[model samples]
Target: MIFNSDTSSDQVQSEFKGRVSLLESDVKQKNCSIIINDLKEWDSGTYQLRVITLPRAGSSVWGKRSCPLRGYCNTLVEGEISAEAGLCVVIPCSFTVPDRIQISHIVWFKCESTKWRCDHGDMIFNSDTSSDQVQSEFKGRVSLLESDVNQKNCSIIINDLKESDSGEYQLRVIGLQMEDALTFSQKATVAVKGLSQRPTVMIPTLTEGQQTTLTCTAPGLCSGSEPTFTWRWRRRGESDTDLTGNITAVKTENVASFAKRSSSTLSFSPSAEHHGTNITCTVLFQGNVSTEETATLNVTYVKEVRITQNASVSEGETLNLTCKVDSFPPSLITWTKVSDHSSRNGTGTTLQNNTFSDSAQLREERGTATLSLFNVTAGDAGQYVCTVTHMNSTWKENVNVTVIYMRDPVITGNLRVKEGAVLNLTCRDNSFPPSHVAWTQVFDQSSRNGAGTTLQKNTFTTGDYLENLRFLVVALLLLMIISVIVVNLRYWRKSVQQGPTNTKSPSGFSNEPESLQDYDDVSNATARAPTSPNLLDDHTSEGEVEMNFPQVRFTATPRRQTTNRDSSSSHQDES
Candidate 1:
């Protein structure tokens, strides 16, 4: 037992010595400690350790001089950490060691990784380094709360903390043992955020002709400078306009933290024009820091519907129809062909016409609805109604599509005619606007007048008449052969009685060929015109018949009437 110091062992057992014990004095395994229940000021002293001697390999090596107990152990006291934002967060840090820590200078560094050690510095503060060595932004900002770092009070203070200055910070005592560096322990983390780090915007559904309110709250959660709020609107095709006149602004504080936050509410009657317009809330912070949040308004309304389609559509062609709907919050649009039977009913409107509704082919994009009718027939051509139902409003528009079709030109008339007959031909076609018709011979490719004598004149030609003459000539020649045969068959004795020489031709011996007018069956030239100018030339192709004075008939009576002829004995040769 050791007593309070009164000059050492002389008083070791003498005065009030009840508080000391050498409980673990066994030197064999080198275990020796002096336990103190409650520390007092007088207990801080060095005492001699005495034990029986033995070799290290033997029992009770407890007494070995080499294992004598002294202060050679290490210990530390670690403190808990807590931090705040927008305000400087102080992390109380203090540490103690069994051995006196010799430090040259204090250095503060910031690093995200705090494993094992923090050697390289984003050095924030260095007590011994030149002022230039510290980052300019942190030069005067970082400091120690306690001037005497040797006292192991490692607390620090950072003024005017920024959100960027949030993270783990490590303090290093340059001269401390490598294992004793504060970087070896879990680092203190600081988090700095604006009282309201992010702006809050609340917008609700707006309907046309209705009053609505939009609220915007600038960022912050704790007490501090209130931010200035401004409201603006951006409509398509229009410049941005400030809306502060309709906006009411008020400063609010969080009851728990006494943190200040700003809020602004805008009141307005919404119209269709305001639909899809951007409402921007800009918060101006201290130091000219500004941020903005934008929200688009969706106002619902419906207006007149515009329907469009091709005026002229070909039969069996696909019909393309577009219905433009001017409404916010796009609504359903149905395209239906209006029926002739469409009538008003008590329940609703119903179409009764022979209408084909292609509801499946309806497609809507943006505010326009498109419908396609496939393989349209002539019946498909009619009035198409585009009905738009948006919110509680309905709009309708009608489009008419006409199917155009045509038939080819058709020619019809008498095609068969006699060789010399007039060729009466006609061409006809049925069309919406009358079509041009013409008659042309397939062989000559000649066009004829529509309905006039001029066309008859063009076809009335001699070539056809000449062909008729060819037939007539053949028929007359056959008749002449028959007549000669008949003349040869009939023979009778005759006596000639001459009155005078009168063959002197009735017209003085004609030499020209006898005109075919003798046939009388031929076409009369005076009745119509000459079949052709060459008709005369064709009739004159035969040699002319000549007439001469008949041999002078003697005045003598018929003397030889019966001379050479006995009845039926001698043939009568009149040659």
Candidate 2:
């Protein structure tokens, strides 16, 4: 060691003794440095300074650091740099000068690359000159790392690099003295090419009739230039179209010295038409370089159920119905008859009354269901439902069925009545939506009056009536018969009380009384109505005779016929 703490070598190198000395200020600051004066061109080379720090009282090992210094002006830089179009890049660089040299400013120039060196080109950035001196295309796009410049860092960041920007770059350092200005011999080669990076897109689950937003982030994280974004949509089997009206786009920026990012958000409502379509997000940088990302849109959607069939059907006619629904991912369609008690079978058909056979068929491709009843009846009149199940939701539609039917009309009450008697008749029929009843006369017997002439005549009568004279004649006859029978019955009873009567007449008949004989003669001449056996035996009380008088009259026809036949036989015997 030539020197150590307060000690000097007795014999020192003649040229280095006076020129080299320790820097006390650097030592007080916990740094190791030395001062060398009169640096010349021959001394331009790399010099390494190393310090071995003795361990504290408790340790025995020593720590050391190697710091390198260069004489004159020089730069440390990479020979080649990689960059992408429409993005940013950083060229890391540093410089050194003689110990006493002070830096005034820095300048950067982009030049065309030649085999041996760089050709004269445009100035991209300058610290000591006005911004006007820089190229128009590169203005405000090239910036120096300001805080690092004082530490001899010549690093620069280029925003929105283009293919034309690929070239050799030179850095010049200016000092106070005219002889101190220097240009670095080593150059940085920027290989800017077409942008191959794609934008990052984030999308959420989309649903029809729902509003959502999509986010697109550009490639670079440089703060120098802001990027623009665009949104487009391409329907399945169709060309791309710009997404406009009803869509909102917002651009956001995040900038800092070390980190910079740009992004855009797109918001809109999605519908069934947007399902299975492609949506693209494109990012554009300052140099007209663009990148894009595409994603297929999948939307969940459904439509209302519809029943397109007439509900009114005539009895004994075929009742056919169809139901349909539109939806995405298809849908389950079902047909059912709505009744007080209704159920569905596993085959997707509803059964209201198992008594009637119903045919149900489903065509999944067309999303339609059909229900057919071969012969409709009153029991088939009810509400029918079309049910649709899509995704996790369900919907239904209903129709009321009407069966048209009617029965034959009927007439009730007396068909014939005595003259001047009021009669009542009722006509009725069973039918759906009740049948209309009317009585129109096709022929009038009273108006013809046994003549061929047509006569319009009106006869007032309460109801159906028989002729008065004919009724009276029949009544008189019935009275005469009843009187005779009463008299004969009295005589018979008298005879019975008087014991046996041997009285006989020339006619070979038992002689009762004159009234009895006359009753027999009258009965023989006119047909006598017969009395029911039960009536004669019903002599338990005399009041019964009167009670059965009407019955006897109505029942007298058979007896009258028998008497007429006896009279006819006697006549034949006499002939």
Candidate 3:
């Protein structure tokens, strides 16, 4: 059977004229040609073609020989193809010839692997090969791969080829010749795979206060694509900035492998400000995918400051001032006196005796500035300012000073006093600032309460006799009474020792008998006189001659002794 490109199998017999009246068997085109340029797994299926034919006659003129005869002519042809995994293959197909025959229909089929059977659409026909005869998995993807359907080049291309496409493919063709009906079997296979995976980025360590360089390397074989590298820096309050670097690629034999490495160099004299800032490197691959790495920057800086001096001060006084600040470069120091005072401006005098030093040592090596003024006077005192310079910045501190004279404390009143006397001593001194008042005494070693006695009442009593006259007088009176009693006793004893007879004797008294004799003579004379007077008167008369003798005797009579003597004498004279 010969199939026309534009004709259908149902009208095939009338459209063709032949000697043999072709009776085309009604056979579905089980296999159809799948023409695919960009073949895929979905393009896999079975296909077929169909044809029909009719009888032909010849006639002769004038005497005759024209005859025509025909029998029913019919045919059917079928074939099968298959596919594999991960590969692209074609389905093989062909057709038989027919005289006065027109092949019009082609069809294809996929036998169910489990049932080993086919359905209606599986038995494809040419006119409706465009119909939903193919399996759902192979519907839109399967197509006619060849240019001419009449030639029966039923080869096809399948792509994105997968394992599931591996199956039996059958083809069926309908035509007029009875002997043209045949089935040829063959199979093909296809395969598919996944793409390559992405790669990782590597980074290095960075130190503070130095230049740091970071590189981001693209991972995997970047066959036909260029790896793009970029860097970003993100800090606390700052926006991100792109970091650029030099990029390069590596290759091996036929496979040109890509390695995208970018380096960003941050050259800075690090400071504390740079700390905790995030520096990152981002690498973009094939414009869609990216890899990144981040690092924290650490910066260091030294402390710094500045100092300045104040203007105008007095003389002869101390000025204390300071200059302080904060920074990184360890502040430098310098001193200058500002002489703006009206008194010192025209005068050729300068008050620059101020000294400078540091007091507190900063633990971070930070310290305090101290300005000292000694023996300051009105001219020496004014505005003294301290200046400190650090990190290109200058700071100044000022102090106003006025100098006044001071005097030592002077003792005003007497400080010495007797033990119990009231002490009133005053100490006074002259000074710019008044001096303090105080009282102190030089202590006496013998006094328990110290040398100076406070102002208070005092009474003294003397135990010495001379000190108390009444006591002395009483002692003298007792001595006088003792002496009087002693004198009286001695005199009484002397009186008792003398006798009373010795007390009566007279010094002129003599123990003589003259007075007694005189008295006795007188008494004798009186007795004699009485006797003699009478005798005498008689004898005197009788004898003058006897008178002599008698006179002796008369005398004896008056002074008996004398008279007797006289009488004895007279008598002796008479004898």
Among the numbered candidates, top TM-score falls to 2
Model 1 lDDT on a 0 to 1 scale? 0.54
Model 3 lDDT, full chain set: 0.41
Error of 3 at 240 (Å): 1.7
Most accurate candidate by lDDT = 2
The CA lDDT at 172 in model 3 is 48
Q: Which ten residues in a row have the lowest lDDT in candidate 2?
A: 58-67
Model 1 agreement with the true structure over 287-338: per-residue lDDT tens digits: 4566678898888777678877775677667777888978776867777665
* Candidate 2 backbone clash number: 3
Candidate 2 regions with alpha-carbon error over 4 angstroms: 1-82, 94-103, 115-122, 129-133, 172-185, 198-203, 208-210, 224-249, 276-297, 308-323, 329-340, 343-361, 366-385, 399-575
Off by over 4 Å in 1: 1-196, 235-240, 243-245, 251-254, 271-274, 287-290, 312-318, 342-363, 373-377, 400-575
Candidate 2's displacement at residue 323, Å, is 4.3
The candidates, ranked best first by lDDT, are 2, 1, 3
Alpha carbon deviation, residue 533, candidate 1 (Å): 62
Q: Estimate each model's TM-score.
A: 0.38, 0.47, 0.22
Residue-level lDDT tens digits of model 2 in 509-556: 346554443333322223222235743544423212221466353111
Candidate 3 lDDT by residue in tens digits, 279-347:
665555432545566666644343444443433334444455555554444465444555775436643
Q: Give the winner by TM-score: 1 or 3.
A: 1
* Models ranked on TM-score: 2, 1, 3
**Angstrom error at residue 359, model 3:** 20
